[model samples]
Structure formats: structure tokens, C-alpha cells
Target: MAALKILGKSSSINVRKVLWTCAEIGLDFDLTEFGSGTPNSVTTPEFLILNPNAMVPVIQYEGQVLWESNTICRYLAARHQRTDLLPQDPMARAQVEKWMDWQATELNNAWRYAFMALVRHSPAHRDTAAIEHSVREWNRHMSIADLQLQRTGAYLVGDQFTLADIVLGLSLNRWRASPIAHANLPALQTYFDLLCKRSGYTQYGANGIA
Candidate 1:
């Protein structure tokens, strides 16, 4: 298989999502660092041509350019026919996509403020009230994940691991690595432990970049 040309820094969670997916699929890729302060920064005109949004993860495959981390992951899985990662059944696919979308929209939104403030130390995100609110919402959303894990007793969408776990697992990694207090979630912890057994998870998802 031809190696994919990926534009992103490995430290980026978004980029790591693609890396983990590729590892799981045994797909080969060459990554160019397009993060802030790098020589090939995302702000550069050349980088913007590939991804107008200036996002870190833009994939070039067979003359096609694709952005959005979750979309890239799904596309790779579908392209490789990895039904174990992304099922063909409509309902199962929808279930996996639902959580992937939640991770991108709801879960990401909930954690951004606190994560920026506490982890990135972004001056713009230092408001104490905002950080507290963000932490509360983040934990609440994770509790919902815990409930789902309790129901499945394994992966997000039942016993089978899917794309949902890839996205959510990284989010969970970020949450754990952050200094914030986590809710009492035994099932979620078990799920994390299970994911740890996967080489792809250890390689990309849990590489301590939180």
C-alpha cells in the first residue's frame, strides 16, 4: 500500500487519532509537523492551502486531501475494510458515529476551557469561574461515558471495539493526565485498562500527551 501523506504534529490529540487508526489498520503514513512554532507551521500559506482551517491533521491520499480527525479515521477504516474498527451494519455504524460525534462536539467542548487553562496554561482561558464550569461539565459528560461502559462491560458500543473507542479513549487519556479531579468511575477505569492492552492504544492514544 502507498503511504499516506499526513500533515500534523504527533503531539496533537487530533493527529494521534489518525495515527492510532493507521496503526490499528496497519496502514503506513508519513507525517509532516504543521503545528505552531514549527518550521512548517499551520499558519503558513502552504499549509493553509491543504487545510484552510489551519488544522493540524490534513491527510493526502491518492491525490485526495481530507481534514477533520474523526472523518479521517473513519475514512481510513472504511478504505481498509476494517469492519472490526468500523462495522458495516447501519445501526452499529450509527452507534459508533454517535459517540465519535459526541467526542468531537460535546466532550471536546466541555473539556476545552479547563484543559486550556490547566494544561496548556493559555492566558485567554484563565478565568476561574469559567474553568470551574468547564471542569463540572467535563466530569458530567464522562459520567455518561461511564454509564455506557457499565452497560457494555467492555467497549463503548458493546463488546466490539469500534471507532467510538478510539476517539473517546484519547479524550479519556487527556482527562486522566490533566490535574482535575475525576469522578468515581470503575467501569470507565476498566475500559481504559482494556484499551491499554492494545498496542495501538499504547503507541498513540496513551503516549502521555494529555
Candidate 2:
């Protein structure tokens, strides 16, 4: 099969999600970075033809075009039958998918305002009150993840490292790199350290890009 073509900048957290997943699955793919620190190439007419939403991390796999970072990761795992990263059992898969969804929706949404204000410094996100609220919310969501890690005593789902870790790990990296003040989360800290041991995390995740 041909190498998957990924469209997105390496500095993007979402794009890094796909890159880290490919590393975990040992999948060979080519990346076309578009929108790193300048005007987004996603809005270009040619790029829009690939993804109508004009988002990065779109993948061209075989003859199919796919978008959504987490979904793209799931597709790559399933395609390679990497059940180790994504289990095949119905219940096991659901367990993994649950955390993946949480990271994409709950966790990701909680950090947007704070990340935009403190990190991206977006003019539109200058509401100090809203930024503080978002920071608190982001920490709260991360605390939930910490509790889960405590329960599992290992990865998010259990002893096995699944797709859940891939998405959540990237989010954790962002949370750590963000300038927002965070509550003490020892479990989360240890989890981040553990993820760092993976070459994939070192290369695509913990590359000081935040």
C-alpha cells in the first residue's frame, strides 16, 4: 500500500496527534505541513478541495480522503489491525473510544479559551475573566483524567496503552506547556513522564511546540 499523505503543520497539536499515532502503529506516511506560524494554508482553494472544513491533519489513505485527527488515528490503527493500540474486542474498543471522545470534546473544549489567550494570544480571546474560567475548567478536566489514571494505575483504560493514551497524552503535553497555573496533579505528571519514554512522544509530542 502507498504511504498515507497527511496535511498539517508539525507544530499543531491535532496534527501531532496523527503523527504520534503513526509512529505508534509503525506506519509510514508523508506529511505536508501547511500553516505552522503564518497564514493558514488550510483556507487555500486547493486545500479546501481536500477538506471542506479547511482543517489540518487531513489524510489521504489509499484513494480515500479523511479528516478529524482522532478519527484519522482510529482509521490508521484499524487499517493496520494494530489492536494493541486499538483493541478488537467490542467492550475494549468502546473503552478506548470513550476516552478518545472525551479528549476530543470535553478536554479539548475546556482548554481552548485559555490556550488561545495565554499561548496563541489571540486578540479576540482577551477576556481575562473568560480565560481564568477556562483555565480552571481545563485543570478540572485534567483532574478527571488524573483520577482515571489513578484508577487504572497505568494507562487511561488499563495496563495496556491504547488509542486513548495517544490523544490524551497530546492534550496533557499542551496542558503542561501552557502558561496557565495548574493544580498539583502528581498522577498526571507521572503519566506525562511515562509517555515521554516513547520515541513517538519525544519526536512529535514533547518537541517543545506545546
Candidate 3:
């Protein structure tokens, strides 16, 4: 099989979702740097012709070009679904897509603030008020995820790991230690612990690279 090409940096959670999706599907990919507020090789004319945004995670697969993290993940799953990252039934797949959209519209909206404060800015230059605000909002959003997990089980799609779990897992990657209080949520903590066990996450999680 031809190896997939993903344009993006490893530090990006968005990129990592596609990378992780490839891993879960028993596929390998080549990633080019494109994010982290730094210019990347994908900005070249040849690359720009493929993805105008020149964003990391614009993937080339099956002779086609695709962008946006969740969309890329879905494409991968739909293309090679034998591994079960995506469901076989249409209803189940729709449910997964809904969670993926939530990851984009809801999770990213709340988490980016905390991520900027804790990961992007220097501790000395960090804004206490902004960080506090983000923490509250993130915690509140996390509660929603927590409730979902409690109502279901170990996985977001209910039992087995699916693309929904893979993508939502990426959006919440930073919450485990982002100065947020999650002491009351055992299910959420379990999900984090489970993700840490994956080889891709272990290699990436280690070194604080993401």
C-alpha cells in the first residue's frame, strides 16, 4: 500500500488526530511541518497548489488531497474501516460525526484558551485572569464530556474505540494537567489513562512534544 502523506507538524493536536487515525487503521504516514506559528515547507508553490491554507494535516491519500483534521480522520476511517475506527452502520457513523463536530465547534473553542495560557505563553507573562477564565470554561466543557462517558462506558462510541474517541481525545489532550480541577471525574481520568497507553500517544506524550 502507498504510504499516506500528511502535511503538518507533530506538535499540533489537529495533525496528531490524523496521525493517530492512520496508526489505528494500521496505516503509516509522512508528516511535513506546517503549524506552531512557524512557516513550513508546505508553503511552497507546489504544496500551496494542493492546499491553499498551507496548513499542517493537509493529507494526500489515494491520489486525492484532503484537509481539516476531523475531515481527514473521517476520510481515513471510511476508506479503510476494517480496523473499526469508524462504524459499519450509518446511524453509528452519524453519531461519531456529531462528536467529531463537537470536537471542532465546542472542544476547540474552550480548550484553545487554556492551551494558549499553559502551553503557548511563558509562565511569567501568563495572564492570571484569562487563564482562570479558560480553566473554568474548560472544566465546564469537560463536565459535559465526563457525563457522556459516565452514561456510556470506556469509549466515546460506547464500548470500542472509534474515530470519535480518536478525535475528541485529541481536543482534550491538554486537559489532564492544564491547571484544571477534575478530581471528581473518574471516567474522564480513565479515558486519559487509556489514551496514554497507545503507542502513538506514548511516544508523543512523552517529551511534552504535543
Per-model lDDT: 0.93, 0.91, 0.76
Error of 2 at 10 (Å): 0.8
* Segments in model 3 whose C-alpha atoms lie over 4 Å from true places: 36-43, 122-128, 180-183, 204-207
Tens digits of per-residue lDDT for model 3, 1-210 = 677888788887778787777777778778767755556676689778887887767888778888888888888888875547777788888888888898788877876766776777666537778777777777788888889998887888687878888776765566775656643767888887887778866655432654
Question: Model 1: per-residue lDDT, tens digit, 1-210?
Answer: 567999898889999999999988888889888888677878878878988998879999988999999999999999999999899999889999999999999999999999999999999998999999999999999999999999888999999988899999999999999999888888888999999999999999888789
Per-residue error (Å), model 3, residue 149: 0.9
What are the per-residue Cα lDDT tens digits for candidate 2 across 91-203? 99999999999998998899999999999899999998999999999999999999999998889999999889989998999999999899899999889988989999999
Candidate 2: RMSD to truth: 1.3
Any runs in candidate 1 off by more than 4 Å, and if so which? Answer: none
Q: Tell me how far the alpha carbon of residue 2 in candidate 1 is from the true structure, in angstroms, after superposition.
A: 3.1
Model number with the top TM-score: 1
User: Residue 88: error of model 2 in Å?
Assistant: 1.2
Which candidate, 1 or 2, has the higher lDDT? 1
